[model samples]
Target: MLSLPATLTQDHARECLEQLTDGLQAEAAQVVVDAAELRQFDSSALAVLLALRRECARAGKHFAVQGLPQRLRDLATLYGIEGLLPAA
Candidate 1:
């Protein structure tokens, strides 16, 4: 499982995506991201996850997020993207 940092805002979005992408390349057919540590975040967090999901799709790997904060999940719902970020 790949772990997200405690804070993931726009300021850290790019860096976080790069790091997670690198890790994703090393994962197996199914990639699971742990988002329990993510305490402070913004819409950028969802962007990063969406980008990661796209990467997973291109690589033919199944992608899911574990322990995503409720608030973030709600944000995804508001954006009509909750279906994109599957829960593990």
Candidate 2:
């Protein structure tokens, strides 16, 4: 399981993505991201997740997220991309 940072904004998007991507390489067929610690964040957080989801797909792995905050879920719904981030 991979964990998200407490704060994930546009400023940290790139670095966070790199770190998560590296972590993904060591995961099994199922990739579960724990987002409960995420507090301060922006849409970039979703961007990172989406990128990670794509990366998982490319690697033929299953992807899911856990502990997604309601606000973030709302954001994803508003963007009409909630389906991309499956819950664990």
Candidate 3:
């Protein structure tokens, strides 16, 4: 499982995405990202999630996000990318 940090903003987006990408090599059909810890974040968090999902798809793995914060959900919805981040 890949866990999102509490504060995911532009400051940490690149590093966070890199960290999550490291887990994509796991030998599984589905990749699960836990987002319950996410609290202080911005739209950059959504971008990180989407990037992870894309990487998973390219690896022929299913991507799922767990415990996504409501704010992030609203952000996704606002950006019209909610469908891209499947709930786990």
Candidate 4:
């Protein structure tokens, strides 16, 4: 599983995405991203999640998010992309 940082703002989004990009290459048939550690973040968090979701889909791997904070869920909902990050 890939863990998100406490702060996932524009300043860290790129690096976060890069890290997740590496995680996606794992040989597992599915990827579970644990988001409980994420406390401080911005819309860029959703961008990172979306990118991971897209990458997983392209690789034919199931993607799920675990321990998503309510605030981040709200952000995903606001962006109308919550469906893509199904709760694990």
lDDT (10s digit) by residue, model 1, range 1-88:
8999999999999999999999997999999999999999999999999999999999999999999999999999999999999899
Q: Can you write out model 3's per-residue Cα lDDT over 4-43, one digit (the tens) per residue? A: 9989999999999998899788649989999999989988
TM-score of each: 0.98, 0.99, 0.96, 0.94
Model 1 error, position 35 (Å)? 0.3
By lDDT, rank the candidates, best first: 2, 1, 3, 4
Error of 3 at 42 (Å): 0.5
How much lDDT does candidate 4 score?
Answer: 0.89
Candidate 4 regions exceeding 4 Å error are none
lDDT of 3: 0.91
Best by lDDT: 2
TM-score of 3: 0.96
> Which model, 1 or 2, shows the larger TM-score?
2
Residue pairs with backbone overlap in model 1 = none
Greater TM-score among 2 and 4 belongs to 2
Candidate that beats the other on TM-score, 1 or 4, i.e. the better one = 1
Better of 2 and 4 by lDDT: 2
